[model samples]
Target chain A: MRNQLPLIIVFATGLLVIVTFFIPHEPFGSLEQRFLVWYSIVAGFTMLLGLDSLVRYHLIKIRDRRSGWGYSLVLLSGLFVTLILGFYSWARYQSPFKLGSPFMYLYSYVIIPLQATMFALLAFFIASAAYRAFRARTTAATLLLVSAVLVMLGRVPLGGWLWQKIVSLIDLLPGTNLSGLKGLEVFARISDWIMDVPQTAAKRGIYIGIVLGGIAMSLRIILGIERSYTSGS
Target chain B: MIVNIIGTWIAAGLTIAILSFLYKDNPLYKFAEHLYVGVSAGFGVIYVWAFDLKPMLIDRFIENQGVERWILLVPAVLGLLMLSRWFGKIGYLSRLPLAFTVGIGAGLGITASIQGFLLPQIQATLLPLTTINNIILVVGVITTILYFYFSRDFKGPFKYLLELGIIFIMVSFGASFGYTVMARISLLIGRIFFLLSDWLRII
Candidate 1:
């Protein structure tokens, strides 16, 4: 009965949302918003559930005295301290980041740098990878590598400085105008052409395929062919 | 002034600690990583509770004291059921919310995917083929779509079309990679600026 009830609710609510999109009127009009509200409410609880699971996993590690159990203690302490400070700060000052609040103190001092640094790590790795992978071994690879280099150079401030100097050097040797109608904005113009023509077309094709795939997948789930959402059953 | 300085020091120290992973993974990086995860999750919990649970659920139901709002108790109960995975016996009950979420997600996806992705993309491709750019755009789109078609074998002319599709796809990927490099460099620049300006006071 429990299982049946949920599936029924799913079927009904699913139909309701799909139907409401076409007919935005009356009880159904506000219904789309109401459904969205309900979805978010459920999502908030899921986040709480996630936190609970995180705490429980750490608790188990500490209890079993696993490797780096001391780190678990730090984890638990940080979690509780942050939670308390956050709610306390929110309740008192109505801002998670109110001045003189512990939440603000921890968030600003700790989280921001850690998050930024984590992503910053990617920059070094990507540069190294690009060096190896972008070697011009074949015609296609050469084209790709050249296009990438052009776009990269065109994007940065130094590219503009270098381009102007080259144009002037060339003009001294031979050329009439040195550059033509698209003189000043030459680098940006190339960048725009690359993006607008080939890139947009390719991206659009990919988008169509993705949308079609999504539609098929959604249909599969709706018809209960995709039952992987169930935990074990 | 003192507090801000101290905060900047702490942030700079942590940033350096994380960057140390580039040389070798060590205890400092692990400690910073663990602390970041725990604190962020904790912040999320409090934020959700204060902004979502307290205002949307608790106050609306209890403080307002309305009989009509009592219906919200349904989702409140369902949310609790979602927590039942912690228990061994009744863990299966969580499947209910999972099913509900999946179904609604699928339904919403069906409508929006067509509206947002399919229709607009087709509309975008319907441009006036007057300029060289327009011709390139149209040809590139058609050839690329043909590359993704799976049901048929590419024989004569289709083979060349597929070949062109591959070229377009490669250039597209190259452009994407270039932009990603730009984004990553921007992030690195941010950290460098912070270290120099805030920590060393050398901007």
Candidate 2:
């Protein structure tokens, strides 16, 4: 009965949602929104479960005097301090996100900069990868390299200046009639086309497959065939 | 004003600390990383309480009357039951809430996939083959879909179609990569701007 009850609940709720999708009656019409509200509230508690796991891990590391326990100490201190400030802000101002609040200050200074810098670090890594891996060794590789370069050029201001200079140089050469097709606009047009037609086609093909797979998986879950959730995986 | 200046300097120091990881993994980067995880988690807890629980559940329960007020108890109970997982004995009870969430998720996925993804994508793909672009679009979609069809060995013309599909896929990936690189570069630029303009007053 341990597993069966959950499975039954899954089936009932799944079927209920599916059935109500077609109905637009007064109660049923608002049912999905109502369920969404309930889901968010439940999901909010799940965040506490996550917070428990994070805190426990750090606490264990610190207790055991593990290799990076100092860092864990830093982490726990940051967490607890932020939490105190957040709750204090909420209590005093009725919103944790009030302007000029300590929580907001930490958010603006610490979180924003840290997260942005973290992602910004990826730019350097991507550049390193481009230098090593973006070789045009084969037809497919060449196509990829060419497209990437064209798109990159189409995006940046430097690309326009370079394109104009190249066009001028080409015009300087004897026996050349490049008049109207003169700037980075050509690259932009090609980039747009690449994104619009072929890219759309490929993405649509992938999306169709994903949708079909999702439907099948949903069916499996609804039927209780997919039991990974209950198994704690 | 003094507080703002101190905050800017702190932000700059953190940004520099994170950026130092590009040179080599160091203690500074590690400190920043750990602090980031903690702060983000703390923010999430407050966010969930503020946005989700406080407004949706507690406020709604307090504001509504009769059945509506009482109905909020169902989710509140389910949420509490999820917290029961922390206890060794009542952990099994958590599965009920998990099951409920999964069921709702699956139901939503089925309908949303059909309405949002499948039909729309199919409709988008169904273009007249009059123009060369249209022909390419139609053929690209068909061949790409056919590429994933591994039921039988595709010999002769089908083989070429599969190859064409891969080319289309590769082009799409290339475009995606280019866009991603640009986005990363822009983010980097933002950081640089903050460092130079906000922190150093150099720009």
Candidate 3:
């Protein structure tokens, strides 16, 4: 009963939604929005489950004097403090002190910087990963390397200037008009075309597959066929 | 004067404390991190209550007495059903709510596909192709699409055309990357200026 029920629901729901798209009936159009709100409520509650697990894990670690007990303490303490401040301020609906509160300061200065720094780390990581991948070992790799180098160069002003020079030299021959707005327009057109066509098509194909897969998965879940995410598992 | 001065000082101190993590983790960073999370959560809850729930549910459905009052019960019931997860014996009952959510999401996704993907793409393809720029665009689109066509292998001249399409794409991507990097650099510069000028009042 536990296993089969969810799968049945999932499949039924998935099929309904798929059909709903073509139907364009009154309730069908609103079906998605209704689901979104329900999902949000469920998600909000699931966050509490996460918090419970986090607290339990940290408390156990702290009790056992684990290696990173201190860090765990920091995480828990942060979680609780935030929860308290958030709840209090939300319930009261008053400024939790003056206009320029400590909370505001922490948000703008500390949190923002931390978030930005984490994102900044991606640039360095990408560079390192690209270095490893872009080795000129084979024909395909060489092509990749050449493309990578050109793209890297084309990004900079110096690289653009060099490209312009090469383009102008090529243009000296008959039939090539590579100067001013015509050149810029051609470049922009080429770039836009690449993005709109290949990138968009590939992305769309992947997205379609993902959507279909999701439908299948959702069907499985709703029909009580997939009990994996449930507690019984 | 007192509040402004104190606020600025608090901001400066917190900024330094957070930035100290760039050097390495410390007690100061931990303090700031905890405080930030707590306050952010508090504020977020308030925002949701005021902006989302108040207008949508309370004012419109309950107090303002809209026709959608009965419809509101569906979500409320679902929300209650989610709490079933907390119980051990009847936890499977949560699937009812989960099913409703999945159904709705699937419906929405299929609908959005038409507007977000199909319409925009068709509009793009319908552009005039007589001009040099338009011709380049048309060629680029066809060639790039062919580059991605893995249904069959590109032999002979087809391979060369694919190569040219790839180069154009790469150059475009490079230009985008350069712009993005400059934006990040500018942001970093701005932050530095904030520290030097507003926080320190040195300027």
Candidate 4:
């Protein structure tokens, strides 16, 4: 009964929300807005579960005295300090949190830089991957390499200079329609052509397929056939 | 101003600590990584409690101010039911809320995907067969769609069309890869600027 009730609630709310989208008048429209806000609040609640897992994971590492478990102490300290500071700052409505209150900095100084730097590390790794991966071993690979090279080059000024020189050579041939096509501008034009033509085409087809797949998956979930979320149960 | 400068230095130092991982795994990198995760999680904890739970759920309900706001109880109950997973015997109860979440998610996905992605894309693909560019775009979209069509076996011309589809897909992927490289380089530039201008104050 416990399991069945959830599924039933899922169906009820799911159908209600979908129905509300179609009927955006008066009570139903306002109800849809409320549902969205409620959804976010519920989502907010899920953070507790996430925090629980994180704490448990770190505590276990500390308890076992796992390799580099000393770092776990640093982690716990950072967590508690940040938590207390954040709450205190909010309650105080001080600088950084409230802005213009002076430099009571935590998020701006620590979290932002750390997150940005962590993501930036991907730059080095991806460049390394591209070195080995962009090999032109086949016809398609060669075309891919060419397109990538053109795009990378065309995005910068050097490609424009080189392209202008080539176009000047082509300019010797008079009666040529350089009307819409300007010298050096051709690099950007080619890049745009590749992006707007082949890229857009492939992207559209892929997006349509994705939408269909999404609809199918949604239907599966709505129909109670997709039970991956209920894995343990 | 001194506090702000000190904070910037701290941030700069930690940023370098993370970037040090490129040489090899070390304690500085581990400390930075743990600190980032722990602090971010802590921030989220405070954010949700202060912003969502207290104001939206607890205080509003306790004060009983906004009459219509009681509708929030539905999701509140559902959300609470989700936490039941921590308890073993009542764990089956969690499935109901999970089911509700899944169902709403699916419904949301269906409507949004159709409205946002599928229809607009189809509308855009209906280009005039005028220029070479248009022709290539039209053919490319058609061929790509045909490649994804799994109902039948590709024979003769269909096989060739599938090959053409792959070429288009490859080019698209290559362009995306190039753009990704550009994006990553921009990030690297950001870090370099921080190191030089902000940290070292050389540039």
**Model 1 TM-score (2 dp):** 0.92
User: Evaluated with TM-score, which candidate comes out highest?
Assistant: 2
User: Candidate 2 on B84-190: residue-level lDDT in tens?
Assistant: 98998889999988888888899898877788778888887788778999999988888888888888899988799899998988787788788889999999999
Candidate 4 structure quality by residue, lDDT tens digits, A80-105 = 88887876776667322576322237
Best to worst by lDDT, what's the order?
2, 1, 4, 3
State the lDDT at A161 in candidate 3: 64
lDDT of 2 at B111: 79
Q: Over the stretch A135-206, how does candidate 3's per-residue lDDT look in tens digits?
A: 667555555555445434544455656667777888899997767632453433443454454434334434
Pairs that collide, model 1: none
True-vs-predicted CA distance for residue A78, candidate 3, Å: 3.2
Model 4, stretches more than 4 Å misplaced? Answer: A94-96, A100-104, A164-183, B54-67
Cα error, residue B185 of model 1, in Å, equals 1.0
TM-scores of chain A across the candidates, in order, are: 0.86, 0.93, 0.71, 0.84
lDDT of 2 at B4: 98
lDDT of candidate model 3 versus the reference: 0.58
Which candidate would rank higher by TM-score, 3 or 4?
A: 4
The regions of model 3 sitting more than 4 angstroms off are A15-32, A91-106, A120-233, B1-61, B64-67, B132-176
Candidate 4: tens digits of C-alpha lDDT, residues B1-203: 78778988998999999999999999999999999888888877877886787777787678775665676687788788778778889878767666766666777887767787788888887889998888898898988888899999999877999999999988888887777777777787898898899878999
State fnat for each of the candidate structures.
0.68, 0.80, 0.18, 0.74
> Which is superior by TM-score, 1 or 2?
2
lDDT of 3 by residue, B141-198 (tens): 5565566667789899889978866754543444344335445545555556766898
Query: Which one is best on lDDT?
Result: 2
